[model samples]
Target: GSFAVSSFVSTIGKSAFSLPFEDGSGAALAADAGSLAGYVYLNAGGTLVRQPGPVVGAELSWNGLRLTVTASLPAEAGISGYTGKPTCVSLSGPVAAGGSEYDVTSVMDGAFRSCKTLASASLPGVEEIGKESFYGCSKLVSVSIPDAKSVGVKAFARCSHLSELDMGGHLRTVSAYAFFGCSALASFDGGGSLKTVGSYAFSGCSSLRDVSLGPALATIGAKAFASCPIESVDLSPVLKTVKDQAFAGLEFRDSGGSVLAHTAAALRGHAFSGSGGVLVAEQ
Candidate 1:
């Protein structure tokens, strides 16, 4: 049942009440009129709270989900949170606060940085991840961002336990140091849509061995895969350039274990520096 804003009694301090919306969504509103002078709505997926202020930002939460609003629009916002120490997070639709519904499309910079307790995250609708969003989250193991198109600089840097990443088919760019120092990461396949990998993107991932550079890959930045144990990678036919030391300390071999030949025109100075691998010109 819907309740008017005027129906709230001041005496109903620190109490909770349930209501049914016209859209058939069930919600519970909790408030502490004594001190917190604000409304917190508990929906199916999460909680949306309107903080007492000029309505600049809000705090969102649920059983295993917590988000802090960073940027607010009339009907949208970017979110990030680390205070609640949530172990698992799942985000799906718009969240309402201060009489407005916000569609969460991005995770703000340094959102969950250094949150050592976080284990996994599923953001099916998020389109972008800002710089250092999950940086230093040492316990994070898996992340699924099916709709994400771009990953910002050092987004997942130093997430030492991160092993699985589902970057979906729409991903195009992985910025510098995005996955740096993710030592547990095993393999990465840029599902036919990736175009650019920035400098040191996967550097220091000692466990990373298998990699599939998508068919659309165009550029590989300096030391992109340095210090990895990767044995081979089939460069895309349309690859335009490989910067200095892109594959340092790695060997390049074909399926038959023979040293694979690369196009000399595409490799910059010392592209294979510190590695036993060699590149030969096409006949």
Candidate 2:
């Protein structure tokens, strides 16, 4: 069924109503607290195509009183298919520390693409972080997605300037280039269900220090942690596979107890092409 958002675009609250999209008329629909969003996807020519579910946290409240997400998303809770301007998104006002959630109707995937100056965001209990979720966010200094689970490929690729990431214990997986060029990230606290780390997950993270792999993760795909400033490879017992070039340009040694040079000799591809560091065997 098609979704509809009413004409009340001043306040961001919870309520549900169906608006008419035919003919030529706009009406205000009042919603309640349990429900918190209203949107109908539009095509390139600005025609309604899909009905977006309840929009939570920040809703694009501009554009002649209408916004559209017509990117053909993956149709999952935390996944994304968002596009266009970064108008006004809602904040949870004031809750407790680690208490408030922005998962009301998570559509963060490609939601804020190339919105480099997005200095504010609030999403929690999100499941899958779609590719390039925050690509090219050059001015993002802080972010708070404490309950995210699976992060899709290039989720934060080329976010050249970001700091203070707070991924809580509930996070699970991370796709390629999850933080490719986020040069300002300092530390990360792995979540619970994260099992896979894809290629370039943290490549070129110039300011990153260290990331403790999740206890349940079993695989580290190629170039998963390629270029960073980390000091060591702190592996978890659940790790099983470290793909070729997974940590190419870093000081990370595999579970094989061999130095990176020696390990790369046995792998399927180069593991230290442009990286700078020493690889000592785990004694």
Candidate 3:
């Protein structure tokens, strides 16, 4: 006779017993079970039950925050028969582990790099994104991180299919190569409090046409908007510096809708060296 098993149970009962191991290497009796220890036994209702085991790769903070250090799946939730890659991931709110609730705060560098199947991500509470966190995820299309303040270098570089990015109102910095080579990105609206755009941050985004620099923006780094097809830019008067080729190879129109004839004030170092026209400084 065969016994039916229920879903994963968080708490073990008094009658639970550890499942037998097949060898000294610590392999469990179940064929698909990983190296994590588990208990399998009959409950009061005569139904077999399994409990959730420990996760292998992650960092727990002293204050109840968790950070994903590696991209590997947990041992208890191993992908034994599923062959398709994960398409969507939601890492928002609190997660329960070891009888304690933890808020997932950040993703370590290169945590999800090259995950080609990842398409969308929602990180509402994450404050910082490490370098190369989602680099080379070709199928990625949308991302929503309303509370994120800083985006590290190469964090989302080479995400070819990424089109929508909601960086929220508190973002302050975009590091170099953050969204480089994302050919499908069409527009960017840097919400309030954005202060700096690092060199080459959005370089090589071929389809980028519209950009809204927030009021607090003060710097535009070298080649930051190079190779894009933008037609005009309404820069903030508080903007203090424009590095070399920052707006290279683009055309600009003035308030009257005519091509600008001369370079604008506060622009230096070939800021518009190769463009058809230069922007007019905001009065």
Using all chains and alpha carbons, the TM-scores for the candidates as numbered come to 0.68, 0.59, 0.65
Q: What is the lDDT of candidate 3?
A: 0.64
Off by over 4 Å in 1: 1-74, 253-283
lDDT for position 108 in model 1: 81
Better of 2 and 3 by TM-score: 3
**Whole-model Cα lDDT per candidate?**
0.69, 0.55, 0.64
Which prediction has the highest TM-score against the true structure?
1
Evaluated against the true structure, the overall lDDT of model 2 is: 0.55
**Per-residue CA lDDT of candidate 3, range 83-134, in tens?**
2476876754666555544455565577678987889988777777889988
* Candidate 2 per-residue lDDT over residues 1-283, each given as its tens digit: 4444342433644332243232123232234422223445443243334343333333333221122222122211232433354433433422111222222334356756787446756566454466777777777777777767777777778877678787777777888788888888866667666677887788778776656665677777787666666654455565667787776665534446454442323332222222246543344
State which candidate has the highest lDDT.
1
Off by over 4 Å in 2: 1-90, 93-105, 251-276, 279-283
Top-down lDDT ranking: 1, 3, 2
How close is each model in CA RMSD to the real structure? Answer: 12.4, 11.8, 12.9
| Residue 226 error, candidate 2, Å | 1.5
What is the descending TM-score order?
Answer: 1, 3, 2
